[model samples]
Target chain A: MSECTKLEMKDLLPDLARGALAGPALAALEDHLATCASCRAELELVRAAQTVLGATPSVDTARIAAAVGRSSSIRRDATVAVAQARRRRAWSVAAPSRRVWLAAASIVAAVGVSVIASNTTRSPVEPGPAPTVAQVEQPSTPGPTTPEPTRPAAPRSTGRAELVMAGGVSDLADADLESLLRVLDDVDTELDVEPAVLLPVLEGDV
Target chain B: MTEPTRDGEPSDAALIARWRGGDERAATILVERHAPAVSRFVASMGERGEVEEVVQDTFVRAFGSLDRFREASSLRTWLFSIARNLCRDRARANRRAPTVVAIDETHLLSSSDPLSAAVATETESRLRAAMERLTETQRAVFTLRVAEGWSYREIADVVETTEGAARVHYHNAVRLVKEYLDE
Candidate 1:
């Protein structure tokens, strides 16, 4: 029989010691070990080390359980603290939407323009020939004053048309100015009515 | 709390699921079942006096990150991987602090059974010193193989190496340890 190489025997030594080798492999390994002094010695050393290492003292399970209990309590408290902090952060930042901001900006701009228009109209100027009371009272009707169009129409009177042209608000009709102010009033009312709903929607986004 | 079945205890996955569902006892059961093995693993890696603390930390960290555990590996293997990392961290921290000394047989001989303890302590001291001579990977592979009776595949998983490399490390470790003990 051929002598077993140390490398081949090294691979088999642990299995041999543990009785894992079976059938012809076991018989072959045993035959090889019978003549191999170094492999025998190496196997002995491995077994000895395994035995020594396996003798490590058992741990105290009760103490570990107690420690785990303490750790879990601490972790629970930390988690609760973190969740509370997140909630506080959510409440502190009322992030309005781009649409809401746009609406708000439109209202502010409209109010500023209205204020300027009213101020300019009221301003003292060199007295020109004042309009006759009859002209003011007659109500310069341009077309049949049909019930207000669902959408804004071009300014009908020359005076109104001049105001639109000078203001550069091509889309504005005298009647639609009242509608824009009403829409702004509705938006302001909605904001005041539902402050609570705003927070959950923003938090969901977060 | 679900009562443990009479035929056998629940699996680790079941326990983890229970723990996630708010049954604290499941967490306790998991700790009790796996803590000793983790402690032994840490101790084998040359950690002493604080094996319990490390094992506790491992469980706490494991539970905290339970959602990340895919259950692809056995829970015990996962715990060993965590314990190995904790050992590495502790070793680094201890290196930074000059005051801490490594524990040895003297620390282990505190048992009431003096005669057997003496014999065991001597053997353990020689083995530990021999292990100390090995590189970290060699020591880990050897200990996991011999001390923990792990297969090369399992050792590879814990040490983050291929099975062939783990076997190579184990053999090299065995030779070095044998030479050290022989001397």
Candidate 2:
């Protein structure tokens, strides 16, 4: 309760309760306990808790060990299988680092708000006035790629590559685009993995 | 069976390396040494029904991810953290986790006499009740320090709080348990 005059020894009540104190420390605690009513009561509380919660319930360790062994064996086998499968698919699979993932996330988030979220935007990191770098070129008409049931077919291509890729990039916005442009300035690795990851996230978040 | 290896026996590090090298018995020894404390901690979290299961899961999960474990850190604290997380997940799945509260139960001096065994027996149920009333983090913070005499830093590692926050939770738990006891 912090009311004990011998306040410094109070934190050690649990140790005293566990019989961890001995020699000079034990003597010192005893001397403090003889005078401090606050600490004595706290020590009592500590003991009561020890007695109540300290009773270790029996657990079946052998059973658990056997289960763990089986789990480990299965996992090892599965890992081996996965390694073989990975070797087979090594050409298709690209595991990006966390830094790469964050950069990609920034790009995806920016795309939903702005049309300018593209790799070509001039990075502020480079010294000079901002260049009129190519933006994520938008389809001027932006006609729905899928013709509406009520409307006739959209004009051919509408000068947009979106019609070919199912329009994932066009659906993104501007807020994260600026960030993507900035990150593109700093971390160039995201550029290599961008085309692979950007499409799926755009479809999901949009 | 719950007793740890005595002073002259192989250290936890050696056992861990052996276990990593596929010595199954080392895993068994680790389980034996840590199961009791893990059981007590899980039970204190008010997840009493699944204490054994949670303990088993803790070891299994820990063993599975031992490669990620920092080699020099205390394995016991790491196991405690994993058990704490498993219990929290169970509570979340059950939708029974109470929000953390800072309880103040000051001025509960019960005549200052040394507590007797009879009193300890009588208060056992109340103590259990008091423990149940504590927030999960409080119980996690309190039990490790009180029952095991762990440092606040160790408790912090288990409970996922800074050492200062662990100290505050420990005191708050002490006060709350006293309040429950007085009632």
Candidate 3:
């Protein structure tokens, strides 16, 4: 009988122990093992090692379950917290920009109102006291005898109407309205009377 | 054969699907089913005394990143891989390398006769000590092979090596273990 190589025998040992080899290969390996003392000892050693290692201690299933339960709960809570924080951060970022745009729109409205008031009263450009709400709201009919101000042609309304439509003016506060009118009064020296007068005419036509 | 589940339970994939769909019970089922195996693998890899903590950490990380899991490998293999990495990280954090210490052998040995039990216990202790003498990779390979009965290919995949390298490691490990026992 031809002896199997030690390498071949060693390779077969694991499969042999697992009862994997069959037919001629099994017969040859067993014949070789029966004759080889070293291989037999090696096989025994392998079996012993497997047996010893296979005795790994079993873990307590209940303890593991409880631990996992706690961990999952904590993780879920953490995820929710992170999501809420992100939403808050988004709102925090968005809130200020909305206020800024609204304030800008109010200032533009105040500028238009100041130009109309100046044209109607023909007031000299002085740092006069702020107009009362009743005076600002009072309509000035272009009287039959009063000369219409020599106003320049009006510029296109820079989409202020659209902005007003998108963001309603009712959200503006009283303090913001006062501050806007004050800023427009400060810029009255640079104001052209023609476009200011034509603005009302444009509105009347609309 | 269909892999058996405890008491006709659903498979891991099914459980994962249910959990994703907001079924809390499925999450509990998955945890109970795989946690022990993860603990055993962690302990076998020489992570003592906090096996449960490490296992919990593994599950937490696994659940957190469940969307990233492509399911190309079996869930068992994936969990083992995660457990192994956690053990490595723990070892690094502790600033201590993995050294093979004598594993508790009493759990593995059982005999009605006291003398046989004592003998079995001693033998298992000696074998475990010899196992400790192996490098981490060799120990991991050997345990996965002998204890878990994983295929060489599967061991290679978990260990991130070629099958040839895993075979070499296993054979070298077996030889060293045998020589230690002989001595």
Candidate 4:
């Protein structure tokens, strides 16, 4: 006897049972349900199902809060440990400038050999038909016309070593300075402490 | 009775300030306030064992990144989104859980509360079992709508689905759940 079909009631039945329908729609559902035995039974069934569903046990709040509290502690500890490990790993990698300096030192040594070989070729040293000193040193030679390779190489290596040492020294100085600043801050904080009341009495020899 | 620090539920901003000002108690309050609904949503998805863990994770993650919360939506909405993601992760890990079939009534009836745990007494367990059969989005929509009683638009935002899609899922889920229970 229902005018509304079962298919239309499929989704709306839940809403109807929930009392969400209003005005004509509510009347229409009511009118339909009054006539249709099957739809009426179906609505009852849905209502019953919802009742049981709504009765699903509430979660134990205390237990959940406790779990959250425990997890928070665990997370904080894990994060701190990971950060410390990353810092340790980062410091152990070779310094960037050291690699650059080593490459520059190799170039300087090659150029020095070139200069030494050129110098020997121009000297008054007599040789039988053996290979010239220039030819003997050819593989090590940087190039022709580059003068005073050994002189430049010595200063260049010295400068590089100085730069490397300066970098290391500055890093150590920063750390030392930071530590000193922290100690000074601590001392300043301690100095700000209010003196005991007995201090004035004792100082006055009372 | 003790009154809250303010009237009509403290805004998330107030709770966050109290939390940042070294109030461990405030953190506990926030956890207690949000955990039940978060746990319910997770549990409604049939994640019984890990529901507590997921709820905890939701809060811890939410608090850690509280600075990023923008307040575009309500704090509860943001928290629900976090909880939903965690639930999906749990659901994805195990595709299905065991269900109590009609034939398995004696097994369930013997082990649980006699009145409330009867196979046909409440539809919650059945609905939950039915939800576990749905795709994650559908289940999320169903739980948010039916269990938490959120609007379709709210469900959409929390689950990052379109409002239309959420409505569709809700309808589909309702139909499936009804059919399952009726059987």
Top TM-score model:
1
Off by over 4 Å in 4: A1-50, A53-63, A66-70, A73-94, A109-206, B1-8, B17-22, B48-50, B57-70, B85-136, B180-183
Pick the winner on TM-score between candidates 2 and 3.
3
**TM-score of model 2's chain A, to 2 decimals?**
0.43
**Lowest lDDT 10-mer window, candidate 3 chain B?**
B1-10
- Backbone clash total, candidate 4: 4
Give the TM-score comparing model 2 with the true structure, all chains together.
Answer: 0.63
lDDT of 4 by residue, A83-112 (tens): 554454453333334435644554554445
Report how far residue A51 has shifted in candidate 4, in Å. 3.7
Return the top candidate by DockQ.
1
lDDT (C-alpha) at residue A119 in model 4: 45
Residue pairs with backbone overlap in model 2 = A110-A176, A110-A177, A111-A172, A111-A173, A112-A172, A112-A173, A113-A173, A113-A174, A114-A173, A114-A174
List TM-scores for all candidates, in order. 0.65, 0.63, 0.64, 0.55
Off by over 4 Å in 1: A1-9, A12-29, A73-103, A106-206, B1-7, B99-103, B106-124
* Local accuracy by lDDT, each model: 0.67, 0.68, 0.67, 0.59
CA-based DockQ, model 2? 0.28
* TM-scores of the candidates, chain A only: 0.45, 0.43, 0.43, 0.46
Per-residue lDDT tens digits for candidate 1, residues A7-126, read 766776776666667988888878878888777887776676666555545666676666656655655665665566566555434333433665565555544554454444344572
Q: Which candidate wins on lDDT?
A: 2
Residue A100, candidate 1: alpha-carbon lDDT: 62
Lowest summed-lDDT stretch of 10 residues in model 4 chain B?
A: B102-111
lDDT of 3 by residue, A40-143 (tens): 87777667676765554556656655665665565566566555655665665565565577566766665566554444444455443434223334335243
Ranking by DockQ: 1, 3, 2, 4
